[model samples]
Target: MASTTSRHQVQDAQKLYDDRAAHYDDSWHPLFAHHMVQLADLKPGDHVLDLASGTGLVTFAASMAVGQTGSVTGVDISSGMLQQARSRLENHDLENVEFHQHSITDLDTLSVLRGKEFDAIMCASVLVLLQNPGQAIKAWAVYLKAGGKFITDVTHPASQISLITFERVGRGLNRPLPFYRVPFQKPEDLQLLMEQAGLRDNHIVSLSQLEAANAGEGIMAYMTDPAHPRLDKLYTIEDADDVFDKHIDHWAAELLSRPEIKNEARKIFKEEWARLANEEGKIEEMDCVFVGIGTKVG
Candidate 1:
């Protein structure tokens, strides 16, 4: 039985992903697909399940890895996302993959998978969003055949430093930023979760990416960008500019308080904002991902 908080989380996730479905692949799918494919280790003629398989990123990769004789089933909560996944499947002319609209937290209710087992189960950057990731992992493990593999990935804590930087900036402004929920904060945490879920011989691998320089854009545009799912939860469309302005003002004020580098800091800040407004300026970002692989050994 899902708790009230869990239910609300699911509803919120569904709405967020449904709205984000169209543009999700443009940004995140490419990053996730690479790690998910390697962690899943799909074999020819294997039957695989992909939970929270958004836009068929991992599903399509698994489909190709499994060859013609194998099959892959993708499950997701957002019908909108599944719709996009189905369209992509058609575009690729993939015959061995199927998708179902279902929540990762409610896998037991899925009729198609009932009384069936899979050679592997893969989830990509999704466990952290669930209210009860442990229970969900345990439930998913039941569908795996004995000695079957289960692979999942989560954002490494080091990769989340950008959010921490934002939080600090918000605090300097005296308006605390809302922290997004991220469950697996450390590698050990995910390892323990997998063990508690009855998975054996767990392995954690780190995948890191160093992005090329970015042309920095306006803070407002960055915040309200359609691909940024957290925007709606953090600020309203109408007051977003006001909120951002306030933060920028406060941040500038804090920088100006320093005597030694005050002038330089102010100049850099002003120039940066100017460049951002004009959609120019170099920005670099990096991400670290931890992929966890375990097997259910009966």
Candidate 2:
């Protein structure tokens, strides 16, 4: 909603998530959602809103916390993700949990949500993906009842290895690449973000753990897969060859015009990924996140 570029980014992100929906729960993503829900400390009969609730991770957790007296509404932009969520919902008789497909930025425009208020609103692992997080927070606060809380999180700047490496490689090449923004470098940045959004009495908590990650294979897929949706913004995928020049941006074409430069860049990207691997052929993934909670001002 901020600009044409922002809209395109959101669309491309939706595609990326849709592509990731099937295997999303195979990782530790659900663990963070549950932890955030615990920090929320929901009470029975409370109505909760989950923004960008992919696969109902937060929604289902909050659903259990709030119990049968309350309801949880999960909203997301990707239909594929929501389909997976809805299927999971079928396995459990959670009448209090429901999912809607809608962009979080447009929540205020929806007839069902326009005048409705929530006891708390939670957005997990999604703040950095927004084009204007502060603006989105301000809009979301309007739907929170007076004194209600808004809960969200920002991961440590170096949290996701493959993504960080992707950005680094793009910077090295001086080539334009679409990447998610990492806005919070420390707890104070998140506190300031909440304060600026008109939230009060902000509380911040840190969660961290070290885990093994297959960074080598992940980065390789991004660099080599022509059909990868992560490159949707930079390339046109039409069953084209893997050669970078044929489908990638003209800038990529210009770079690949020199065969030596192309090979050098490719080698650098691959070696960087390899260099990150440990003795077990995996990277030590630092899973760090800062959860921020703030009450809506009256």
Candidate 3:
């Protein structure tokens, strides 16, 4: 993460994530399966690293996939997120997961660990938020063993069309939400970044299929966010109300209980996402951005 690219410091991002930690797993969070499916391809003894392992989402999932023989170390700049991650792991009784509070982009110090290289590194939705993702990728490439895979999953630029961005979506609603994008950052740009970082055997995965499976519709459904349907599956019927009450007024939020508006919104979204689907892969496939196993080129 670059000082200039990030308007919010690590502490700030961590703090924001920490606030959502308790409810993080409530909904299906379609992206969860994105990395899980990819990492599952690795052998048990493989070493893995998750950059910006916020609240242990990727780390926790990776721990289960890697098993005991494999080591999973998560590096992030937020202590709050690390603490939450640690707590979640302890609750799961996972002993193989290790987390260090540090900036993952330029990992100059291993005072935190003895290993110098990882078999695979997963960067989940963290690239565009950085100051200079290309440089960061190059710097972090040193930690990869030869043939190691560097995977990055980010909110697709095509996402702008559907409205997955919170700030932008917020404004579209009656209430104005945060409107913004850091600028010059997109999955396409990051793909170029992987090349500059000297990574090879690179394949970009257009992550789709989660809309009907988990969460609700495509990533854009998060745009209107009136009902905040993302949590539809992650929670029991008991705590759903509290989650909505707390979050509905937050930003591009919508309360789905309103009989008329809720039904109408659902209809519109379904029709739109469905329409996007029938067109084939033309106007960007309906899914988040994903990076397949990335090999270190040099």
Candidate 4:
């Protein structure tokens, strides 16, 4: 039983992915490919299912690994994204891969795939976006054959410094930003969810650890970077420069108003701004992703 709010979220997510379909792979592929490839772990002649398979990043990779004898089916809610995926498959002459349009939240919609089991079910970087990730995970596990593997990844909130920084600044200005539509979860929470879903021998892997690092580019550059997959979803303001400038000004003013650490805050602010301005500034933060794997119990 899904909540009304969750239903609305599904609509929103579908729109977002559809809007981003054309450019989704361009930014996301490089960042997420390594983890997806590693977790797919497809052997020759193995069957794989790729849920929310935007642009077939993992789908194509799995197809290659499975070789000619194996098959890969990718399902996504966004028709635009599926269209791109289909084009890729046709262009590559990949006969072993296929695509279907289906919402992850609607398990009933997956009835077309009923009576089918997979050697590996991979849902990369998609669980966090769901309105009911736990429920979805449980549903996905049913498609796994006994002893088959279930794999998914989520962005760890702590490592999302930009969003955290924006929220802090927004709060200081008394204009709190909206919480991310797709909220993150702690590693332990993921483990518990998997266990509840009847997946055994759970394992977790972190792709990158957050650290004090600086990007040599300014906030605008960083936000607009084509390489960062999350940019479009996170930065929705029409004029990036104007919005970022106001945020910095207000944030700086708030910092200066504090008596105890005004001086230190100003220094830190200047350094941060300078770092954003510099294309070579060492941005001291790492994006972290947690990949969880579990085996379906008999």
Q: Clashing residue pairs in candidate 3, if any? A: 5-131, 26-234, 27-231, 167-178, 170-177, 171-177, 226-254
Clashing residue pairs in candidate 2 (N, C-alpha, C atoms within 3 angstroms): none
Predict model 4's lDDT versus the native: 0.65
lDDT of each: 0.67, 0.71, 0.57, 0.65
TM-score of 2: 0.72
- Model 2 stretches with alpha carbons more than 4 Å out: 1-7, 168-178, 209-285
Candidate 2, 1-298: lDDT as tens digits? 1111223546755877888999999987887787788778899999999999999999999999999999999999999899999999999999999888888988866677878999999999888777678888989988899988899987665466545544445556654234544456677888897899889999777664323235343222212111111211121222113423332333323332355455655555566556656565654445466789999978
Please list the residue runs of candidate 1 whose C-alpha ends up more than 4 Å from where it truly belongs after superposition.
1-7, 162-183, 211-286
State the lDDT at 76 in candidate 2: 93
Please report the candidate that would top TM-score against the real structure.
2
CA displacement after TM-score superposition, residue 46 of candidate 1 (Å): 0.7
Ordering by TM-score: 2, 1, 4, 3
- Per-residue lDDT tens digits for candidate 3, residues 137-209, read 8987888888888887555444543343333323333322222333433445556778778888665554442
- What local lDDT does model 1 show for residue 74? 97
